[model samples]
Target: MKNKPAFATMEALAAVLIIGFLIVIFILFIHPPKQFADARNVRRTSNVGTILTALNQYIIDNGAGPPGVDGIWRVLGTADSGCNINCAKKIPTGIEAAGCLDLTPYLVPKYLLNIPSDPKLGKPEITYYAVRQTINGRIEVLSCGLESNQ
Candidate 1:
């Protein structure tokens, strides 16, 4: 009788351990770590800040902002043709632009070596966007990245 009780206790413990292990696996699958998303968001914020700083520097050096007929220069190329100014119409989504901006005057090896693409480049639903705001005839660069929202 003593041996039987010990055997039962051992079996119960083994079953509990197995169940715990299974639960852990299930949880891992259901709720994967969000580190990747968090990291991407951080990168997006950094990239936006970098671009904004470059734009500010460009303005200081040139005494005027980049050329834009309507004061709105969409970053990146257009979605369909990846053409910057030649695109038929502008799309609001930042990820769809083929190029970063038409501010070539500012990018002559001075402002930025290369434009920074979104961390999630191919995912057009989320990307970096920039707009030049003119207040009192002074140019201000405003930017937002999709990852920041996440």
Candidate 2:
């Protein structure tokens, strides 16, 4: 009967609406854009923590700060191409202040296998992180690129 065809058309429409609802839920709740930023932030925090831990362990083992100095902010990456010969050294970036501290000698293959970089916008040469010793001799590590505004 004609009613049977209309019923079938209604069933198809209902199925399509259900599918649309599920897709909306998936996009809004299961895979929102904010989740990606949050994940990057978590990675940044982990990188900071690992750097701090390695720096602390080095101090405990050697009985002295790695830099052998205090109260200075040292960027934790290689100098940019602009530095020319000083490329091997750390240079300032937008994330942190001037002065580069290459922890490779102090941390590489000893405290950490190698220095870790930012989850994004970081390379082996320029870790988007910085480390400094407070005037009181406390070591502080920070991530230059933190996502999620956190």
Candidate 3:
């Protein structure tokens, strides 16, 4: 009788451990943290597209580039905190190493209701978004704060 009780306890413990392991596997593989990361990436892609479209429309309407668009990556957002003009240092990669483009005056109310920010670290001072015009007049806008190894 004593041996039977011990065996039952061991079996119970093993079953619990297996259930725990399966739950962990379900959380890790079946349902992953990557879902949130994927959502953020989607927002970033949408933001980039919105910014690009706004810039293109601005160019079409005005027949010229918005301010501070000299073929360099300009951080998009309001300028502040002693980094009045070029806030490239704010970006992690610091692609252009130049100014922060304040498109609020130009884009807001006309091209866009308001400038879009990064899904994670967006702010008015430095939106974590970047824009630049290529030499061929192609405009590029991207989210500088891409997440999940992106």
Candidate 4:
């Protein structure tokens, strides 16, 4: 009898390669990379922490926390509106102002050079929030988009 071919035919090799390519595609679709997501979370946490620290410093220097547009003491605002008072108002300067909470105290040559925006900012959703709780009279900064539980 004639000896069988020791190696696969060209057609069989092509078929195997095609199958491998398809499998790779499927795997990529099923499990996307988490690096981008993790990076965004890290940046968000850093931004939040920076703002919180600046707020504390502002309080120490001014002898009072920056005033909220609604009131000195306010509940935490939603991500959509930022802080409770003037959620839509643009902060021209960081100093205390009416119709909005001014973070200028933290921005102008003091704490932060500029206000750090959320990674998903301008997406028609709130990503960050702040409020001064009445019970303890402390400023609370929050990042709604933070990935980690703590």
Candidate 5:
């Protein structure tokens, strides 16, 4: 009878409501697949680490590491674009005197392919904070953890 049609309508409405609820849940719990900056921060830190190692090596071999402005820019294959031209023979202005010293100058190496810029913050604006220390008489570079706040 008429009741049957009413029940059918209610069923459809209920189904629609359920679908809407699920959609809300999906939006709340299921994030769109995207590479967030937090995920890319690891790579940035690793690149920083690599640069630190290279600088340490440079110091060990030359009796002095690259200039300590922000730190040292990586000079790829002796290109002299980053630290080579700027700091190899002389020092460059890097960082506010109190800010994290720029490290891009000492990262250059004959085998290093290129300067690994931060993927999240992009080049020249490296948001990662760093600190230099001598651990057990060895130069150690420390960086802010996942949040880059160090």
Candidate 6:
């Protein structure tokens, strides 16, 4: 009789442990928390679109594209990026060494209040590259439906 009770107690403990594990799994599936990875991707993508639109508006208001590479000329002057805070060194074009320019300066006259940042990009900064175009063979604001992986 003593042995029978001991065996039953062990069985009950095992059953309880199994049930607890199943419950944990169920909870995880039922209310999935936002993944930082996915969140960062969404933010980065959306920000790219938003900034692109702002660039367009800025250009429409102004005559030409912002100075320097990637409209980053704003960084040298102590102005705001309007999308987010970017003290970016100029994006290189064909390995030109003097190509150090911050991309924020192009969106002038309040293009954006604050720059959108990628959550996963090590410091909540944008990691996408800009595509610049020329109007009548003159450089203008940035453009990007498909950007580079910088």
* Model 6 bad stretches (over 4 Å): 1-8, 23-34, 69-100, 122-131, 134-150
**C-alpha lDDT of residue 69 in model 5:** 23
Clashes of 2: 0
Candidate 1, lDDT over the whole model? 0.54
Tens digit per residue, CA lDDT, model 2, 54-114: 8888889989888633665555766653211121223343433354567788888988888
Those runs of model 5 whose alpha carbons end farther than 4 Å from true positions after fitting are 1-19, 30-35, 69-105, 109-111, 125-137, 142-150
Q: Is candidate 1 or candidate 5 better by TM-score?
A: 1
Q: What is the TM-score of each predicted model, taking all chains together?
A: 0.56, 0.75, 0.75, 0.55, 0.48, 0.48
For candidate 3, lDDT tens digit of each residue in 42-113? 998998899898889999999988978768777776664422233333444465544467989989988788
Best by lDDT: 3
Q: Give the per-residue lDDT of model 6 (tens digit) for 1-150.
A: 335455578799999999999999877865444454445556656766776677667667876555553422221222223322232433323222223234465664388655544444322132333435444533332212122332
Residue-wise C-alpha lDDT for candidate 1, range 1-150, written one tens digit per residue: 335455578799999999999999877875544666677667767766776777778778877666651245455422444423232222344323345455544554688776666676523322344444455654443334343244
Worst 10 residues of 5 by lDDT: 82-91
Error in Å for residue 117 of model 3: 0.9
What RMSD value applies to candidate 2? 5.6
Clashing pairs in 4: 79-126, 94-103, 94-104, 94-105, 95-104
Candidate 5 lDDT, tens digit per residue, 43-110?
Answer: 76787687566766777777765555223322222222322221212123432233334444455345
**1-150 in candidate 4: lDDT tens per residue?**
888776669878998999999999877875444556678778877877887788788878888866552234322222323333333332222213222234554445688776566675412223344434355666666554544333
User: Could you tell me the TM-score of candidate 1?
Assistant: 0.56
Candidate 4, superposed: residue stretches over 4 Å from native: 1-33, 69-100, 122-127, 147-150
